[model samples]
Target: MEQELKAHLKKLMASGDVAGIIALKSERGMAKPYLFADASELECLCLTPKYPMASVARLLLDEDGAARFAIVCRGCDERALRELAKRHQVDLDRLVIVGIPCDEEMARECACPEPFPSVVAVGTKLEQWEAEDIGAAYRAMELDEKLAFWKHQLEKCNKCYGCRNACPMCFCKDCELENALWVKHGRLPPEFPIYHMIRAFHLAGKCIACGECQRACPSDIPLMVLNTLLREDMEELFGYVSGTGADAENPLYTKEEMQ
Candidate 1:
């Protein structure tokens, strides 16, 4: 699969469709995102150890508006890119996506439902996995029980901001989390459910369910449970599934407001 993807990327570069190709390059034993402009460098290209390629792409695009690139994207990566484009953080017209389908094992690891992008350039597309609803138990709990659960989970927070830093969707320059009026500086655990509730409300129609927040949290807080529950509620209430496409209007606002 790696070889096939490498070959496809080389062809794309050779065709002069993009200035470079953004994909993971293996150096020694580490894999990181690298822009491959020369076909010779394709030999070092790898597909493991997923980094936030969408975030990297946004940075590159911001640095050079005229530059065009092709990105090797998994399902989540593509979705993130679409979300960024919708928010005017990226110009999708300047991008050529090279889609790669995720295997079942990778799907299970991330608890991802759709493991493949819109188009597959390499690797066989696998069937979508039935992701376990991680919020089931929490949703089943009574009102007081739910409060107790959140208190226990949120109390472990050390105000590390790992979850915020790792989230691809958290690109606001003036973040509500950092505002002293809301979260209060120099305070641990962040004022009960205030910090987390604000975050969840903000992400109601925007979270792509990449699981980066939960993975980055050192406190082992099951952040995805809250995110997943909100995601479902957004879909049910507004008929909006975030990151699916760039053109879809956010149902949280009116058409006039969007303009």
Candidate 2:
């Protein structure tokens, strides 16, 4: 399957299906985004230590929309790209998805519900994941306990923008978090529940459970608890799952929500 992917990428590059292929290349022993133009460069491609290649796609497409490009997408990357397209952050028409199914270990590490992309171009799909009771257990807590949990977690925040920067869905040019009025500039803790709540609410209809935000947090905050709760809320209120489909409408943005 590894050879199959290498051959496929070579074909895509040679045949001009993609002017450039956005894939990971080995650099300093780390896998990072590298644009493939030559078939010989395909030898450098690697996919481990997963970075958000879709986020890289978002940036590249902005610069060269007319050029065709292909990206190596895991399930999370594909879904993130779909949601980004919904916001006009990415032009899907100019891109190709070379989907790669994640292994079971990666699936559990990500806590991903859907670990397989809609299509797979390389590797056999892993069907099972070890489900975590993160959301359900947190939901089972008493109101006071829940409050304490959040307060404790949020107390560790240093006001770094790691979470937002890592998120592929969070594409605001001028973030409200930067505005002194919303997040305030008083102290180390920032604005506490309000600061985090604003971000949580903003991600209501957009978060795809990729766990990038959680991974980027320096404070080891259980941000996934907040996201998983919101995911549940979105599903219950509108039967909406973020990144489920490219064409699915975000109810939060619908005109009817205003009324």
Ten consecutive residues with minimal summed lDDT in candidate 1? 250-259
Query: What's the true lDDT of residue 132 in model 2?
Result: 72
Candidate 2 local lDDT, 1-259, one digit each (tens): 6678999888878787779999899877777788888888888888888788889999998888499899999998998999999998998998899999888888888888788799998888986565575799888899999899899999999988899999988889999988888888867887679889999999998998889989999999989889989988999999899988777888998877532
**Which residue ranges in model 2 land beyond 4 Å of their true spot?**
257-259
lDDT score for residue 44 of model 1: 96
Determine the C-alpha RMSD for candidate 1 after optimal superposition of all C-alphas.
Answer: 2.1
Name the best candidate (by TM-score): 2
Model 1 agreement with the true structure over 4-92: per-residue lDDT tens digits: 88888888999998999999999999998898989999999999986778988998899986989999999988998998888898899
The TM-score of candidate 2 is 0.96
For model 1, which pairs clash? Answer: none
| Candidate 1, residue 105: how far the Cα is off, in Å | 1.5
